[model samples]
Target: MGKIVLSTNVTLDGVVQDPDGQEGFELGGWFHQFVGSGDLEAWTAAETEEAQGAEALLLGRRSYEWFASRTPSMADRVSSTWADSMNSLPKYVVSSTLDHPRWRNTTVLNGDAAKEISELKRKVDGQILVYGSYQLVRTLIDHNLADELRLVVFPVVLGTGLRLFGETCRRKPLRLVDTRRVGDGLVSHAYEFVSVNPV
Candidate 1:
């Protein structure tokens, strides 16, 4: 079975939105503005490396839109670098209104996320990676579908914005598998689901 790994760049307060001044949330970009210069490069390299090993990519509509708009010219470049290396890895976008994906090797899924991911895990040989889609990640967590989480926490606080982990979510216990300092001062923490204890 394949693992569903949720990787995100978060703040000290766990905010994950627009770390790179791309989200247009006005207060969105935080990490990039504050973190050390080398941190960003190191972080991206690590993420790209993880993504290269994935058999498929799962994204939320917002993330899909962001990438589609931002990397229009780099479609081929992205595919060749990341998608092609993974044998043209497929992408599943979770959205209700997205009729079709403009990007190649992409599919729009409008169904039970947990069931779909569970089925995908049974069939795929490599990992299924989820990046920068907090909504989808939350759903996966709520459904207990996420197997692991890779968080690169930057040393800054946005004070407000979309958080990586919302306050309404039920507490989920995780086992810290690894921790390392990447880039300048950014800390990367890898955690696996240990158990879903009742609150």
Candidate 2:
């Protein structure tokens, strides 16, 4: 069975909003500001390891559009394994509203997102990676579909914004399987979902 891995970058306070300041969120550029503070080589290596295991990319509509619009440009500018993996991987976008996806190796999945992901899990071998698709990740969490979650935590705290684990998120118990230090104050925590019994 293919694993559904949820990967993300967040502030210390758990904010996962527009880190690049592209979406009009006032606290958008926190991630970029702190880029030089950490061990960039370790962080980049972690990302490359992640891409090396993924079979395809799974994203929400907005994320799909964001990556679709930006990643190809990145591929044109950079010659790296991470860029190559991102630009070449098959990507499935979960959205009811997005009709056409023009990105190379892109497919739009319109239906119950969790169900579609479940079906995809059965068909693919390797990991189905999700990045910056917090809402969809929440759905997968609520439905108990996510296998692993990796969070690259930056040290700064954004006082307010869209958090990775929001108020609406279902409470889940996760096992910390691994941890690694990224750039300066950045750390990556890899967790595996586990069943929790009600007290």
Candidate 3:
């Protein structure tokens, strides 16, 4: 079965909103604060590695639109290799109202998201990577459909923004599979599900 990998960038305080600050959130550009610290090589390398392993992408509506509209224009950027993979990979977007996706190799799924994802897991060969789709990630987690969760935590406290986890999320336990310093102030945490859960 293919593994569902939920990966996203987060602040030290658990904010996951607008890392690039392009989304108009007040603290949107929090992740960009560390850009010129001379540690981007490690950061970009880690990102490239993940993109290399992903077989396909499973994105929510917002993330799909956000990435689809921007990634194609980044082929000449510093991490063009990663951008190429993102643009070329087959993508499945979970949306009920979205239509006319301009991104090639894109499809919209409007049925029961969890059931559809479980079916996808049984068919795909490699990882179904989920990026910056917090709502969909939470749904996958709540349904126990996510096989892995990889969080790259940046050293920042946004105090308030869209968080990685919702307040009413189920108490699912995770086993830390790996932890690494991806960069000077960035830590990557890899986690898998644990049988123990709150009763």
Candidate 4:
């Protein structure tokens, strides 16, 4: 079975809102503040490594639109190697409204989200990285579909914003499998979902 890995960048407070300040959120751009503060090269290398390791990408409708609109080629702002990996990877988007996706090697899952994703996990091989899909991540957690979480935590507290876990999220157990420091304060935590009913 393929592993569903949620890989996302968030603030120390778990805020996943606009990190690039493009969304006009009051507490936006927390991610950019770490540019010169820490070891940027190390962070970039870490991100690139993750992108290269991922076999495919899974995203929600909004995240797909956001990334498509911002970085069409997936190259401009990101490293060429990382961008290349991202552009070449097979992408699956869970959406009820999207009729056609412009991104290459893309598939739209418009049916029942949980069932489609579960089937996807069974079909696909290797790691399927889920990025910046808040609602989808919650659904995965709620349904016990997510197998692992790789969170790159930035050192900042955005007080209030769209957090990773909302009120709709249910209780789920996670076991910390790995932890790595990217830069000065950026810490990456990899947690494996602990199955309540083990098979």
- Taking all chains together, the TM-score of candidate 4 against the true structure is 0.93
Residue pairs of candidate 4 with colliding backbone atoms: none
The segments of candidate 2 whose C-alpha lies over 4 angstroms from its true place after superposition are: 76-79, 168-170, 197-199
Give the whole-model CA lDDT for all candidates, comma-separated: 0.79, 0.85, 0.86, 0.86
Q: How would you encode candidate 2's per-residue C-alpha lDDT over 56-102 as one tens digit per residue?
A: 99999889888888777775454387888888899999988887788
Candidate 4, which segments miss by more than 4 Å at Cα?
Answer: 72-76
**Higher-TM-score candidate of 2 and 4:** 4
- Candidate 4 local lDDT, 1-199, one digit each (tens): 8899998888888899998888899888878885554556777788789879988899999999886665556576667788788788999999999998988889999999999999999998899999899999999998988999988888888789999988654568899999988877788999999987644
Residue 84 Cα positional deviation in candidate 1, in Å, after optimal superposition: 5.9
TM-score of each: 0.86, 0.92, 0.93, 0.93
Error of model 3, residue 152, in angstroms? 1.0
The all-Cα superposition gives candidate 4 an RMSD in Å to the true structure of 2.0
TM-score of 2: 0.92
Scored by lDDT, model 1 comes in at 0.79
Candidate 1 on 147-175: residue-level lDDT in tens?
99999887887788888887536778899
lDDT of 3 by residue, 3-120 (tens): 9999988888888988998989988887778554555778888888898899999999999988888888987765999898888889999999987898999989899998898888
Model 4: residue 77 alpha-carbon error in angstroms: 3.2
